[model samples]
Target chain A: MSEFARLEEKLAKLRQRERIAGEGRKLRGKGGDALLAALVAEIDETILPRRLSLVTPQGPVHLAVANRRLQALLAPVPGSLPEGLADHALPDIEDPKLAELGQSLKTLLAEAENIPVTARRLDRAFGSDIGVPAVQLPRIWTVAQPTAAKPDDILSGFLADLGDAALAWLRIEGEEVTLQGGEEAAVAALSEQAAIFLDSYFGKFDAAYREPSLACGTVIAPADGSANAVFFVEIGEFSAIIHAPAAQMPSIASDWQRRVAE
Target chain B: MDITAELDAMRVDVQGCALVAYTDLSSQLVLSTSAAANPVQEEMNALSQAAHLALDGAIAEGAAVSWGGETPAELAFLMTGAEVRLFLRSPANSSEALIAVCAPDVDLERAVSEARATLARIGGQG
Candidate 1:
């Protein structure tokens, strides 16, 4: 065949490849939409209504009560009330246990609301995965107006403060932290810690009008022969450690600095 | 001097010349080339509406406008990406519309220029 014919053939193959890839992407997008639909349905049928009942003034409030119990079970060590609920009227119920549960649920929800922000702050401060659990960690963040200082200055200050706690946890957990995917036990422990940290953090920012921000990061273990835990700080950026062993801490302090500079 | 004849000659120069009409503030095709009905006409109608919307305030005094080198109008053109299907309305009148279905990659600036020149020839200045 002539050189032109060969080039044409190659172009045709490239086009075919692109078409296939496009189709694959479409299929994946459809699958994702289906999954999202299912999740929405589940939330509607179960979680959402339960959450609404707790917020509503008049109803059976059964889920609200149950939520409180779940909150208590999930509380961090030396637990306290979530910032938002500290001033809200509690359920005027007779059962001491039930009342306690309501308070705990309120606290948990408040804490849950702050996890993402706290996780991001921690990731920025000490380093990503320094104290992260081996599971799908979802972060809930709220945007704050830049303080009197410049935006970068405020972010730097926040990172500095968060570094202290993140480092402490990292030191304590040290080598014992194993890689795992969706490990309920590990996630439960991380969630407890996250709740405590977030509750305190939210309290500090309670004066401002807050919005919900949820971000999820996946923890990949070396046992599974995967790269370091992939921490998506926000929706668009990924923090990955290429060479680090999953068993060891990924050095992210420098990486954080590089990213901020960029 | 029949400006309509001059505009028709220009359209023929570009080949496959179809109905080229100049619309007034009322959107009535004041002057147009005698062309058969086709998808291009429908596209032009849409473009007219869009142009009117975009040039809403500018049309009163009449501003030079043009758009072309798009699908259903231009031949030997490559499909760029997405097709442009809409109307163009000169600011002269909300009703005055220039519509065209153009190739996605049509030279918008050129089309706008041609349109304005055509309007000028027809004594419509915007």
Candidate 2:
């Protein structure tokens, strides 16, 4: 072929390839949405009916564990949930486009099952694979070693940077979160306030947060977790009290994290 | 100690204090309360109970675990479009909490400090 003819032929091929690639991109995006839709339909049709409700008249409690977040989905079935937790159930589970939920449910469930407990105290006290089975039915120990950063410097620095943006700042010492940067009396009273809030809040969960950085709202509570362990939270004007790991704050990146980011 | 006098004192200390109450979380009874436009008796009773639940209730337990199984938050402020409600647990005593309702634009830092001082005085007596 002549040089000009050859160039024209190459240009046509490029256009054709571009069209194919565009179509593929559309499919990839739709493919994710389609998968979530199918998953929702599968659970609504099969799982809901198959699993009889032990507590409520509807279906059984089925939470959607997105990656590490134990998200409370509005289970068609009712009972088996605390009143406060029940109130936290969000209606977005069935939405085709769940927030940042691009992964498949199968993958998320698998990850949720293997979030790595670290057995907090289990490994430290007794080395791995050395569990005992004595007494009777056999019991195992698995829970210990919090990775939360010491709040002293972090809280003070954060509070200083936060200045008046924060309503109050506190550091949890055992059973009380003593407010930082206050007089002896101010700290005492603030500490009491923080302690009572935590004591009452954790008391209700009856279990620790499975993963760190829950990022909870006042109305939308994520109650499903591992134990009554340590975590971080920021309650803001939006009425949202976001939770995350104590050692490190949650990744929400709202007003609270502004200082930490610096 | 004169509890009413104490609450009244707090009212004076707290600027733009809409209402101030010294509540017994256990009984949900307002021993002595002062408000610009006082809510009914039932409202105060409900406020006292709600304070207990929010500060030391089931959710607080979950929050405790999230906080490395240590003590939970001490000060919880309930924000709204119209006003702000603060719940402060006395370090000296857990059974009592000081509830204050203030205007939206009130100086919270100053308000919290003054409230803390007042709570210490009341809690000290008990």
Candidate 3:
């Protein structure tokens, strides 16, 4: 056969292989069909333009199809061989299943195209954080303290300073006061000052109160000769504790007043 | 007084949260509360921080280019995927920041519209 005829024969074989592959893809899943469709689309839209080239052991043999599979089959033949001899070495006739597969693939692609493109919606709205449980605040307090101030009074005071979301917890230890709150940093700072005030009060009044630093910067105030007062603060997810001498409670309140002013 | 409820609400709307919280950022569990069962909390918090950073960066640059106005950008890592977008622009009167998070492949137009609405709701402009 002439060189042109030989090239045509090879092209026919490649088309047959592609058809079979396309059908196998359809049998697999939607994903497979999608892939096959994409490949066929590329071939139709892009690959057909001057795509084919043939080569032998020595050099290239320019053909009408640039398909890689077809080129690979022709690659082993020596360049000096005549077109007729090259044609004789070509693979057997194209598989008949290819046409059937090609028809099914075409039908599958048509169905996929006809399917409506629905708007993708999430069952639950997307959030940077979702379904995750709230964080657990550390257990840094030991006991609750009695206060002349009501819960509303304390909450209102905290709200005035740190928004409505603030919270406070108190723990009492022997001759020591600890205060904690949601605003850990601010509470910590207050705790440190409370401790200072308690120490100073005990020094002046000759009272006894425990000095604890386990809660960072929390003040332990001496409420009286036998007990101490502690304050806790929490602002949203943040928290802090303050402990001071119960005997020096009045002084600690005055200090808070002064700091708020500043 | 209900800090947990308030935080839950804030988490629903706030963009780019950067908390110096005493609790784990992932689980959203307040460290002050007693510990409980939660396997994915840590991973969630880490992802939130990363998402916040990504959204912040996008907003820092004007939304028109980075976000592709009609369609927001999608977040894709080796294992996880999410949708996030940012919009920062000068309003008719002032300058403000706008960031939004949506499911993967969220429509850009809708995200931008919702972000604008959120900013308005929160007293932010543009």
Order of the predicted models by lDDT, top scorer first: 2, 3, 1
Tell me the tens digit of each residue's lDDT in model 3 across B70-96: 332121110001222222221321222
lDDT of 3 at A235: 20
Give the local distance difference test score of model 3: 0.27
Instruction: Give candidate 1 misplaced runs (Cα > 4 Å).
Output: A1-262, B1-7, B10-20, B25-48, B57-82, B85-100, B124-126
Candidate 2 on A45-119: residue-level lDDT in tens? 111112111111222333332211223333342343333433142233333323322232322322121121100
TM-score of each: 0.23, 0.37, 0.20
In terms of TM-score, how similar is model 2 to the real structure?
0.37
Q: Which rank order by TM-score, best down to worst?
A: 2, 1, 3
Candidate 3 residue B69 C-alpha distance from true site, Å? 20
lDDT for each of the candidates?
Answer: 0.27, 0.40, 0.27
i-RMS for every candidate? 26.3, 11.2, 26.5
lDDT of 3 by residue, A225-256 (tens): 22334433222112233333333323333333
Task: Give model 3's docking category.
Answer: incorrect
Tens-place lDDT per residue, model 1, A1-262, is 1312332343334333322111100000122223222222212212100221221111112121111111111112123433333223233322244344334443434322211111110111222212211011111111121122222232334334433213211111111222222334433333233323222222322111122211111111122212222111211111111112222212332223222321
Which structure is stronger by DockQ: 1 or 2?
Answer: 2
